[model samples]
Target: MTIEQAIDSVKKGCKAKFDSTVELHINTNLDVSKPEQTIRVSVVLPKGTGKKVRVGVFASKNVETAAANLSESDIAKISKGELDPKKEFDVIIAEPRFMPKLAAAARVLGPAGLMPSPKSGTVTEDVEKAVEQVKKGKIEIRTEPNAPLIHTVIGKRSFSTADLAANFGEVMAAINQAKPSKAKPDWIKSVYISTTMSPSALVDIPDLA
Candidate 1:
């Protein structure tokens, strides 16, 4: 099925009481063990993710307008299990200098997929811009730790099919652009779209080479 048809099918199949998140799942052929084959990058969906994102910033100094300003002590607390970042924010943006400090909390944040990294544009000198991007539907896409599978929320079940299709196109474009230099010409193996409570609908994979 095409993206539009798949999205329509999934939306029709949604039976949850509340708005459900539409997700895109892709299977790839690259072996992630090779550093160059790893795919990790952030892309802004033009139509947005259809949900509010709570952004937290970790910096040496306070950022006046940041949703949540995290300090060195907060990082320490997270490393020691005294703080649970997941309960506070949906996304975390960090300054380059603070990355070393975040390492201690990696054991805690990594598994949750909230750890800030340069590859995902979460580690940068400009905290404000990063926060804005995230709030405006910027999302990180990466393959799973032990598999060549990529999964992420594309939009909401309530969104129009056209809007959902637009967001899906942007994600695919980003993924294609991030294709590793050494990856095979045909990197994507399959594509599927589904809402949180619905069965997945297999869709034709775009030309991602």
Candidate 2:
């Protein structure tokens, strides 16, 4: 769907009330064929979604030192497979050549789908930007268990429906244009959207179609 359609869909399908905080979940085709390719995007809501996400970076000290990328934060550290990957973080980052290192954490991260992958743009020179995105409401998604889950905050309970809809549309476009390819059956199996401490409501992916 184009950006316009995304905006329209969110406006029509939104069910949250005026005094309710909520989020949006989108499922669509994305472009991720090239590791170096930049994912062009814009935040409809200038203030942007507010969600605290953790990032897990796995790299050799040499590799970690080679680049003056992002400063390592508590959330952006090593997460080898031996430990509980899910508990470690939400997103995973690693050197493109060292995907094998992720094998150990596969069992843990795979199920939760936090496995670091070059195809997903986790192997990037702009490590700082990658981490910063997570600091925003950017979500970590995978194609194994489900088609593609794009979770992002819409707004607080105080936001107007139109404001929330615009934010939702931008997130939809981001998810749709994230990877270059579409899922075999479709990019979405199901969708559930909600806020930080609220319950999610089922949203039909067809809204975007």
* C-alpha lDDT values of all predictions: 0.89, 0.51
Residue pairs whose backbone atoms clash in candidate 2: 30-179, 30-180, 31-178, 31-179, 31-180, 32-179, 32-180, 81-104, 81-105
TM-scores for candidates 1 onward, in order: 0.93, 0.52
The candidate maximizing TM-score is 1
- Give model 1 RMSD, 1 decimal: 1.7
Top lDDT hit: 1
User: Tens digit of lDDT per residue, candidate 2, span 1-209?
Assistant: 44334334444555656444465655444333533222333343444454345666654443332222222332223343334546756666666555655564456666676666555667665655665655555543333233333555666645555666666665666655654443444745565565544545555566655
Task: Compose the digit string of candidate 1's lDDT tens values, residues 158-177.
Answer: 89999999999999999988
lDDT of 2 at 140: 37
Worst 10 residues of 1 by lDDT: 200-209
lDDT score, candidate 2, position 47 = 42
Task: List candidate 1 segments past 4 Å from native.
Answer: 206-209
Candidate 2 runs further than 4 Å off: 1-21, 25-47, 60-82, 141-163, 175-209
